[model samples]
Target chain A: MVAKELVLKAELRKKLGSKHSAKVRQSGKIPAVVYGHGQEPEMLSLDEHDFVEGLHHGHRLFDVQFEGKTEKLLVKDIQYDHLGKKIIHTDLIRVDLTERVEVEAPLIFKGTPAGSHEGGLLEEHLDHLEIECTVTEIPEAIDVSVKHLGIGDSIHARDIKLPDGIKLITDPDALLISCRLPAVTAAAPAEEAAEEGEEPTSPEVITERKPKEGEEESEK
Target chain B: MALMPKRVKYRKSQRGKMRGNATRTNYVAFGEFGLQSLETKWVTGRQIEAGRVAASHFLERVGRVYIRIFPHKSITKKPLETRMGKGKAEVEQWVACVRPGTVMFEIGGVAENVAKRALARVAHKMPVKCRFVSRRHTIG
Candidate 1:
C-alpha cells in the first residue's frame, strides 16, 4: 500500500559545491529537491532543523507547514553525509489520503521471552517490512508475542499480525525467530563421556550380531 | 508585470562577514536530540526476527529523535588522520563542516539510546564491517 504523502514548500535548487551550498546553509535553509509525479526535479530548500525533525518523527511521512495548511508526504530518497551518515538531500512523494498507498512498516516484538528463564537463546531476524494499503490503514507498528516460546521455536513472516484490510507483502516462510543451542566445552574428561555413551550403545551391539551356532557358546 | 515575490521569501541576518576562509580549529555545535517513529508490516514470504521486531516496536512506540554524533575523535583512541576511511569531503562553508573527517547524522527519530542500539544491531548483523562515530550527547 502507498503511504499518505505530504505537500511540500521549498525555494531554489542548490548545486553541489562549497561556496554555493554554503550560502544556502548560512540562511538556516538546507539544500533539498522535490520531484515526483511527472514533475521536473525542482531544486529546493528547507529549514535544517525542521527537515531533521521530520526525519526523526515522520521518517516516511510528515506534514509540511507550507503556504497555509500543512501538506503530508512520504520520504522517498535521502542522501546522507555519506554511508550511514547525516541526511543531506531528501526526496518526498506527495500523497492523497483517499488513495491506497504502498509503504514499509517496521516489525515489533511484544513481551519478554518465556524461554529466557529456561536459558534458551532467542534471536530476532527481520526488522522493517513493506506493505501496500490505505494510508489510514497504516499501522504505527506490528507486534508479535514471544510468550512461552522455547528452544527450537520459530516464527515466519506470515505469522506477524496484520490489521483488517492490511496485507502482508513479505515472504511468509522467512525465518523470524530461532532458538540456538548452547556451545559445549571440551574440558570434560573423555572417559566420563564415553562411559555415559557405552550403556546406550550396549543394546545396539546385541542386535547387530546374533551369535553363530558354534560361536554362541564362546560369545556367551 | 513583475513577479510577486515568488511566494516564499528568506533573508539572512545582517551581521554577516566576508567569504574568505579562516585558519580554523575543528569544532561543531549540534542541536537538541529528537526521536521519530519507525514501523514495518509482515509480508507473506519474509523472515521476521523477534528482536528486530521488538526493536522496531520500541522505536515506533517511543519515537525517533536526533542526537548529535560529532567530535567523533574524542571518544575513540584512534586519531582522525589514522582512521579516515574512503573519500570524505569537508564543506568550505557552513559551521557544521569544521572537522575534516567528522560525519554527522539525524538518527531517525527513535529514542537516542534506542536508535544507537538499533544501529548497533545492524552493524553486527551486516555481512561487512561498519562503524559509527559519536562525541557529545545529552537528552532534552
Candidate 2:
C-alpha cells in the first residue's frame, strides 16, 4: 500500500556551498536540493527534527511547501555523516503524480520457507526490485510469501505478482530468494576418521625448506 | 607496533584474484553500522591497529568496535643495497587485501552520534576511502 503523504514546511535557501550548508546544519536545519522534470534546481532548508521524524516513519515522498508554493517530491538520495547516523544532505526529485516512474521498491518476505525447519537456510539475494508505477500507485514495499517454499526451491523476479498498473523494470530472470542446505562444517573430516576407527590427521602445512649443503654440492 | 605472526609457512604467496567472495567471512552480520571500502588496497596491520585505537579512544569504551579485516598476508621487503639475485626477503609486515565493498569495521552498542564520531576517527587512519553504511541499508 502507498504510504501516507507527509507535508513539510521549508524555506528557500539563499546561500549555497559547503560553508552555508554547515551553517544551516548548525542552526538546527538540514540543507537540501530539489530538481527534476526539466525544472531548475531549488535550494531549501528543512527542520532537522521534522525531517528525522518523517524518516523514522519511512516517508520517502513528501509535499514540500516553500514561499506559499508546494511541490510533490521523491527523495532520490540522502547523504549521511561518516557514522551513517545523522543525515547530512538530501536530494529530492520532483515527481509528477500522473506519470509512471521507475523506482526501487524494497521486498518484504512474509513467511518462513518450509525448508527452514529442516536445516535449509533461506537466503534472500535481492532485497529490492526496480519497478515502474504511477506515483499515486507506488507501494511502500513488495511482500513475497515464502511459506510454501521447500528445500532447493527458488523465487525469481518473474515469479512475483505485481499489483495492477505496476510493471517490473528489473530482469525477470534475476534470482530473488532461494532455500539451500547449510554449508559443510570442519567436523566432517573428524567424523569420517571416527567411522574408520583411526585418529584424525592434522591438515598438511605447506612450506619451503632450506637447501642442504650436500644437495647444493650435488647440483654443482 | 602491532602483533605479528611468529612464523609463517610461506614468505610470499602467488597473486590470486579475489574471485567471488573467497574469504569465508564476507558480511557484517553484527553491528549497527559498517565502514565499507570503496576501492581495493593493502591495509597494513599498523593501519588497522591505529584505527582500532582511534575508535576505542573516541568511544571511551562505551561502544563496541569490530575490526572486520585481518592482516594475514605476509609482505616482505629487501634490505637496502642488496643484490637482486638473493632469495625473497624476510617478512617485514602483514597486510589485509581489502577489495571494493568490503566492510573493514563495524560499530555498535552506542548512540548514533557517538558511533559516527568514533568511526570518523577510525576513517582518518585508513588508506582507502570508505563510507558509513547502516545495517538496514541493503547492499547492491
Residue A95, candidate 1: Cα error in Å is: 2.2
- TM-scores of all candidate predictions against the true structure: 0.47, 0.61
DockQ of each: 0.02, 0.08
lDDT for each residue of candidate 2 in B1-140, tens digit (9 for 90 to 100): 44344456765755465543214333454666678876678889789978887887786545467788888787778899988877777667778888766789888545568777888888899998977765664311
Compared with the true structure, what per-residue lDDT tens digits does model 1 show for residues A75-153? 6666544222355566766566676776667666666567655655556555556677875677656677877577678
Candidate 2 chain A: worst-modelled 10 consecutive residues by lDDT: A199-208
lDDT of 2: 0.76
What count of clashes does model 1 give?
58
Best by lDDT: 2
Which stretches of candidate 2 lie above 4 Å from their native place?
A: A185-220, B1-89, B97-134, B137-140
Task: Encode model 1's per-residue lDDT on B1-140: one tens digit a residue.
Answer: 10011111221112233232212321122311211111111111001122233344444433322222211111112345665664333211111112222222223322346666765553343222334443321110
The number of the candidate with the highest TM-score is 2
Per-candidate clashes come to: 58, 0
